[model samples]
Target chain A: MTDRAFAVVRAGALTSVQDRGRPGHAHLGVPRSGALDEPARDLANRLVGNPLGAAVLETTLSGCAVRPRCAVTVAVTGAPCRVTVDGRPAAWGAPVRVAAGAVLDVGSAADGVRSYLAFAGGVACEPVLGSRSTDLLSGLGPAPLTHGTVLPLGPVAGPPVYADAVPWQGPPRELVLRAGPGPRTDWFTARALRTLVTAVYRVSPAGNRIGLRTEGPPLERAVDGELPSEGMVLGAVQVPPDGRPVVFLADHPTTGGYPVIAVVKERDLAAAAQAAPGTPLRFVLTERR
Target chain B: MSTMRVLPAGDRALLVELGSGEEAEAFHAELLRRRARGTLPAVREIVPAARTVLLDGLDDPARFAKGLADWEIPALVSGAGSTVELPVRYDGPDLAAVAELWGVPAGEVGRIHARTPFRVAFCGFAPGFGYLTGLAERYAVPRRSTPRTAVPAGAVALAGAYTGVYPRSSPGGWQLIGSTDAVLWDHARVPAALLTPGTRVRFVPEEG
Candidate 1:
């Protein structure tokens, strides 16, 4: 195959192509879908010498495996995982060169929830709205990666970075998110804010790409019924009728009716993506955004 | 008109609240005009909803929000947007209920709904699906107490003061009144959604 493609050998539990998500389409009810762990995806891209927003594979919990049609340099980041080339151990966070026809395996996460794998020249799938990201919400772009799926690759962009020591922050023992007020703060009781900060919350197993469901104290509503549908931004701490706050993520609906009590800082959300199920989450209410 | 209130949604987004859906639509139209004319500041997304418009990915959310206070928004141009015609068959199960709600004979339901012009107020619930406004407040209807397990694609429905066509098969609560053959969503097409925010629409009745 002269097409420079990588065939999925072991399709993990959930794997999809992602880059900087297709934005500017929220008005059409399109979610801004992209890499959950932005910094880790960027680091993988940097190691493989691809552009900042080049497409890469985002593997959930159990990682995926791929075999390139041509010699390639690849890097795996995000959740710490066991990576192997042709049944031999390979670097997990650093770039490794693999010859054509060799199986590159990315195993299950040791701590985090998602892992990012970037290949040299990036996955060159036909861009939908100028993104390769698979939006689970709108069902846009490519579908989730499956075994035998062959994805084309773009031409190499730049030289790969082989660093001696790259700063790697391990997955948090307890997730801390700094949150600021949302537009519908008045909908919740005064004690709701206190409960939000003081109450213990864990990342629920029901969480998906759309939002992080939290198992915690249900916030008391000051008002009754739902609001007229309003735009939902990333990190929106929306309190549903059930009263549990669900933190909006990359594939969140463009608009929602549930009242949003607060919005976690965008920087803090990258960590939220890697948070494993049952990980303790703390929402620190801050005066300033 | 009440002053447009700009509330903070997050550090990256600001929500501008309008008095009603009509005002929100008008503001969205004006914002589109400014964005097209290169007058609006650099922002990532402009999402319109029931009574608000959210501006996201702003470099300085505070500054952009402060500008809203100093500006005057123009009203939306009536009958201005691109109009799409849909051939609809009024064969829904709730046709009688809707007719009773309108105090009109079952036969008149199709004629009355087909006559009114519609505009897409905002899009939500799903992609390619638009919340369309056309009927007056008196024509508004409540949603079904028990929503359908699956509302088929191209199903024309009504809720509150809005009418919408289901883009694809999904669970929905709107009262189904008719059906359309026109594809509401086609991702392969240039503009995937047949109906978008601010679009004008007219339904033509299909002969039995």
Candidate 2:
């Protein structure tokens, strides 16, 4: 009998199983922990003919190496990286067949910070709250992959979708995020608001799944006292006492006390995820729709 | 009557600001009522916090914002919801310290806690951990100067106008006063969180 599983050879940096994530449980203090690069994950799954909600591996920075116990179709997307099967070059952004016991290696990203690897059947893991995405903050779902981890793979669903060419967008040299006024915009000083849009910022190395912390001119506050802790939203550009802006991401806390000066449009956050540490960032203020 | 301020949280959600925690709880209850009646559209989450209720993952936030203007805010009594009794054994490491801060006997600490009816203000910090209110203003205590590396699960703890039970073992700073066997969170349960927003709770002291 053919075993349907893959053994992790090299789990580079941080790799974990991710899907669309559990969203409706914010009231239960659960973070919406999903693939940071949603389009990439979706594309990877689509190329492999897997359902959009099928669980896939999300690799950070350095990519991972896996050996399937059974033959499977695989596709790598998100960051442009080297994909190889048994030391032979494989296609990135397109489906490639991997024979059983062949080592499938996804190399370190050339320009982006994260990559998505989708197998034909998808990584089948026990779902917590209807999601396989790992919540780093809450320790929900499967833990980050380690060497020697054997992950089960679901049976192939359908034929892989073959495209003439798959367009891959390279990581931005200067990340441009569209910002709209936040609920607590009044908390910041007028000059600080101007600085937020005018001054150049860099992606802080300290950024994690929780938020995209920025290193730039601090936004001075107009309000003297702390705002009571209130529910926070994704893309909120929250400013702590340090005066720097921290764009809340998928794993952001359900509630926070700091004031939010602006919120980045959700569409632009996919690019923010690929931005490497110290990538130049610019906030473009836009009128609310 | 205080007016509710509907503010944009993001493109997808709105934060409705209320005057107090009680008002936030009341608004959350009203929203839940509207949802149950099918009057409110599908929303991903209705999260009530200190002074606001965040309506997240709305299909159309702009349209919903307009609808919120005409929605009537209902007056509700705090702790009016069904109550869940949690039996706790008061033998935490922070019991003596919490008792010292209140200038009461260690035995009296559990008595005061059990006497008060606590309403779930909001759930945060951890899954199924409810930040409950209803303790007197005098019981408002500061968090420990240094947080413990790891607080055990089922630890009934208190800090800054809120008393909560540790749903699962994790690092926490709240001063522990007791421990309970009642499950605060279970994924297999219909509603994973035992304590949700607007649920009233009672901490019953037990002899261990």
Candidate 3:
């Protein structure tokens, strides 16, 4: 093991390396797969004094544990989670030093579905297309972390940023998405549109990096035949044959055949990433800004 | 020069609705030409699909939409663009079923497929996978009733009015007619996808 490498002690349920995803590749049928909670990932990198685009570990509801080959500064952000070093309690949002060969354990998220962890130096995995983000849909970048996996770390850029306090938002009790009318709003009945905005939906447990599937009143379509396959954008609220709206997330497909009634604002997607299953969801349609 | 509708896909993206896939392709090519000339700014991605082209990551989507409304779409000059030829072995499991559907001998399937030239209409389902159009309306077929659990990479398949090659192993419902060894996607290759929208494609069957 190199001095700047870490071995995974426990990989939890699902853990993958992520950064600012590979954009501008939709034309090649590639998805923009990156950290779902962009702000949290950015904050973790900032706390560790790493570049904003540095690759970090994105853990699912259950967190992970790693043992570095060398002492390093680390910060955990996103969902508030229990942090420990060799069974001793450690800081959650602030930078903390971990001795070489010591285990850094991140516990299950307290309230959210995902968490972000950043090292003093970013994960230096070989990038497939200028990014270390693991794309689940297209199978690009590094694979999800498994137990005993070793990851190389980049050179430390600078000392960690010491701060008295770091602002963090808790998981949304109700995921409210501000949406704008879209490419195929005319395909749905007027009552379906009304139901989309007025009805209450809950996040489906089947939701993953691909989309936030919802369970609610099935939307009725005015048109019968399927629309020709069309390009889909992030945050697109696509309604499939099942009629439930599935909001495209970071790892969403580049094209889809379903009608997209609206697109949620990109800013609100971070909260959507944290919204646990069964969380109420409401869509407020607004004029395109 | 049919009238086009530019709808707001989101705050940063504009979806232009063209009447047909050919129109969408022409519009996409025009946008790429304009982008090459440095006229389009803050344009992140131009994704051309069956009947619409989505322009994403623009600084001002509304302003761009206004410009697109006035932009004239050029005629597509077929045979003037790049073409990728793929060599195939006609030994797919569904070849007999597809031949039965067409009421033709199984051996005639490969010849019929290779005779027609295909145009990449759009790409989706997976990376580097292009939905090619060329088959006549009579050849349009429905997807298999049950999807396969694992379709091998490079499997040449057809569904509806489109034919496509599996970029990688994935579950699919398309009727498999052959297999190819050509690399569809490679990160090391420039323009990773072998088939991009507007590119022409030809399939050549290996002689027994």
Candidate 4:
């Protein structure tokens, strides 16, 4: 791999490289830690013409500002971040080609909470355990990108430019989600989850890579006894004694003790990942097989 | 009345409940047997818990259900099974604390930890991590009230009915009793994780 540099002009709170994430090791207790906004990440990559699973940047809470070492083309998607290249405004949901040494800045969006940046080729980081995504919870890959960190990019095949949208936009929800039965649904109080799925829940400010705290009707567990620690999965809605359901996300641990009442559908994950604080969500159970 | 039910979880996963822990164990064993014989289709992984099993598979639910219906329950492994010895250094910060809570000698904790071989119960959460069950009764200790922000890799810990080693450094609430140098997960390895369900493990005190 050739060494390159793409300086972070203004690194926001959290900016890290991510790919499709490490999969196929669930038996080993590993979470499939990757891009939080999967669809946005995919769309950005496609716009820049990178492979579907190629590594891209995941900027969380706040946004980021970047400057390529040489002439490079890139795309931005997710969280609707307000973007500008070399002080000239650019649009989200599209790609932009920059001349050599052009500076690109990403600012927080009025709507969502995270943004994805895809290079024409892909963000080339030293892959750890078959993925380039940063597993902050596991400390498995490169640390989050900082202001001075120079990211290396690989060679691209064509000129940088924006592409038209394809036909794959997902469900439209204020807080998008698809639901499924959890591993320990039997532990939940009868109809407790029905209330959860039908009621509107607000995202508590207490949210991070591990899980999202939500405020709604308290979900009661049937068996009061402590559960032996067991395996967990991304999107698992775990209820602790406090009653608020914590939805596990990308950097979740391998196992937990609290009862999990539901799992968010994989396709609905992107919307949840980009949910801003106070966003209200309502889970609609589906007959989808 | 049946106390549990099987439900479709997603496009590629299912949640099967067997009521009690014993029933879950039996069902998991049968599923494992079917998996080994290549009789199960579409299933990518089968994770067993105290009373349920989460089956993740390639995106075909109908085919997976068919495979489940066709599985034949197999006999459990009898007598002494294959055992792999592991060297563990009994110097974790929580070892003495856990021993005192158990009303046992601190040094005796190590001996008890090694007394009986533990079996891999299930795997999930992160890659190459294993949930080991069947710890000796005396060694059982509740998890810490507050989890550590970061538990170093290879740290061996126990909580409730299970004990495990942290595959990578992360936040944890388990009571750490020891550590091991063995690599539980190496991405380059043909099969990354060392422990799979039913694999037996014995911890030998490290000499240093």
TM-score of each: 0.96, 0.97, 0.98, 0.86
- Candidate 1 lDDT over residue span A122-142, tens digit each: 999998877899999878899
Q: lDDT per residue, candidate 2, A1-289, as tens digits?
A: 2599999999999999999988989888888889998999999999999999999999989999999999999999999899999999999999999999999999999988999999999999888999989888888889999999998999889899999898777899999999888989988888998899899999999998889999999999999896888888889999999999999988888888899888899989999999999999999889733
Give candidate 1's root-mean-square deviation (CA, Å).
1.6
Candidate 3 regions exceeding 4 Å error are none
Clashes in model 2: which pairs? none
- What value does the lDDT take at residue A5 in candidate 2? 92
DockQ, prediction 4: 0.45
Worst 10 residues of 1 chain B by lDDT: B65-74
lDDT tens digits by residue: candidate 4, B1-208 = 1444566555677767666665666678877666688866656667777667777765776566655554454445543345667789988899899889778889887888877668777776556666777775566688799999999999999877678888878788899989999888876676767776667888888777
lDDT of 4: 0.75
Arranged by TM-score, best first: 3, 2, 1, 4
Say which docking band candidate 1 falls in.
high
* Top of the candidates by TM-score: 3
Candidate 2 scores an iRMS of: 1.1
lDDT of each: 0.92, 0.90, 0.92, 0.75
Ranking by lDDT: 3, 1, 2, 4
Better of 2 and 4 by TM-score: 2
**lDDT for model 3:** 0.92
lDDT of 1 by residue, B99-125 (tens): 999999998988989999999999988
